[model samples]
Target: MTTILVTGGTGTLGRLVTERLRADGHEVRVLSRHSWPYAVDLREGTGLAAAVAGVDTVVHCATNPRGGDEQAARHLIEAARRAGVRHLVYISIVGVDQVPLGYYRTKLTVERLIEESGLGWTVLRTTQFHDLVLQVLQGSAKLPVMLLPAGVADQPIEAAEVATYLAELATRAPAGRVPDMGGPEVRTFPELAGAYLRASGRRRPLLNVRLAGKTYHSFRAGGHLTPERAVGKVTFEQFLTGRFPARG
Candidate 1:
């Protein structure tokens, strides 16, 4: 069995990836700031070398989009090179290169770093996760009426499905940048909010509010969507039903 190190193994997607890898009988180690077994801080380079030592593959899912994702990527790449890792798999979001968001820009920077690191690498770009969409809905639910950005479309996939795919990628030979993955269905933000409201037994009027700015324009133009590569099977409705059962 090959030894694999998963960065950010305690986070939403990272936890799923770690569980899947361990279930498949691979020797797994998790590198995170707070997780037990192997606690490594990617941003500070603490315990990273030890965590990656003797590992055959390193799956990079750790990210700090708000502040220091680039630094974390650099630290991990350097440590992996020193430990002589055979393969490095990176999980990223779709539209990072096309969108002008600060977090997206950092993700693109990390992708470039991995490409030039001289290590065997594969990058998988997936769309947003269902949990993130639900968080957005929850944030908006506090308002008197749920207001959503007009013309914004999203293709949110299940995190577990993406984790399964990431595990598959880790076991295979590095293929560089692979095809993008997205949810099976696409829907506007308002529609998704409506579904969430219905699932939670909360009825609230939804208003389509027009937004301005380049970021809004990019999102409205479908930069966050991958219709042709919608390989994920779980739909938003299914995700809501699973997470929030109908009220009795």
Candidate 2:
């Protein structure tokens, strides 16, 4: 049986990946900073060798939005090299190379680091997660008028769907930079916001706020979208329905 280690194994996506791998009869090791036994902080590099020891593949689902991801990856690569790991699977956002946002830039950087690493690797870039869209709607729920980026759009896929693909990737031979994964539909922010409002049974006026910046411009231009690769199964609306059941 293939032994795989998933970094950030406690998170939403990572948890699902671990489950799928185990269900397929592969040995799975979960590593998180506070998790017991395999608790290894990728940022610190300590305990990672033990965490990655003897693993056949590593599904790197861990990330730091605040910063320090490069250092974490450096530590991870070093440990994986020492462990003689066969494959390294990475989860990245679509348009990382095109987007100028700091986080996107960092993701692109990590992708490069992995590609250059001697160990076999696979990188999957997908659109935003449905969870992120839901979080945005929730964050703006208390406001009388929902404010969304005027020209931005989202093609959000279900995290579980992503996890399924990642699990499959882990079992197969490493394929570098697989096809981009996008949600089934390319929807405008206001349209998605309306969907969220309808699902929550709340009526709030939607306001489109245009911000000044290259980042927003890139978003407006659909730099983050992947219309050509809309392979995701669950639509954002479907995901919302699951979160908020309809009332009779």
Candidate 3:
């Protein structure tokens, strides 16, 4: 069985990826800051050598949205090289280069670092996760009125679907920078919010606000969408139903 190391294996995507890898009869090592023996902070990167030792593939799912992604990636690259890692699989956003947000910019920077790290690498750019969209809606629903960006749309793919694909990629030869993947449908902010409200049986006044900023403008322009490669089978409605089933 191939030996694989998954960083941030405790997170949403990483957890699923780890499960898929293990199910395929591969030896999977989970790297996290809290775990013993394999615990190592990617940003600090102090003890990463031990975690990466004898690892054939390293799936980088650890990311810091607030900051420090570049530093973490550099340290991980060095450790992977030292451990003789054959494949470095990375998950990135679809419009990382096109979006003007700071987080997106950082993701783009990490992608560049991996490409030039001199190691075999595979980077898959995908649209937003359904979980993130649901989180945004849940946060907005806290207030009496839900405020959303006007005209913004998201093709929310299931996290499990992405995880399975990552596991499949890890078991093969490294394919650098694969084609973008997206969900089945591109639903607008209004539609997504309405769906969440209906599914959760929550009532709130909805207001679509046109915010000023290059980032929001880019989102409005669908910079983060991949309609051409909509290969995902699960729809947002189906996801909601799974989360909140109807009473018989």
- 165-206 per-residue lDDT for model 2 (tens digits): 999999999999999999999999889999988888988999
Q: Would you list the clashing residue pairs of candidate 2? A: none
Q: Rate the local accuracy (lDDT) of all candidates.
A: 0.92, 0.94, 0.93
The deviation in Å at residue 224 for candidate 3 is 0.4
* Worst window of 10 by summed lDDT in candidate 2: 239-248
TM-score per prediction, in order, is 0.98, 0.98, 0.98
For residues 112-205, write the lDDT of model 3, one tens digit per residue.
9999999999999999899999999999999999999988999999999999999999998999999998999999988999899889889999
What are the per-residue Cα lDDT tens digits for candidate 1 across 140-200? 8989898899989899999999999999999999999999999998898988998898889
Clashing pairs in 1: none
In Å, residue 36's CA in model 1 sits off its true spot by 2.7
Clashes by residue pair, model 3: none
For every model shown, the clashing-pair count is 0, 0, 0
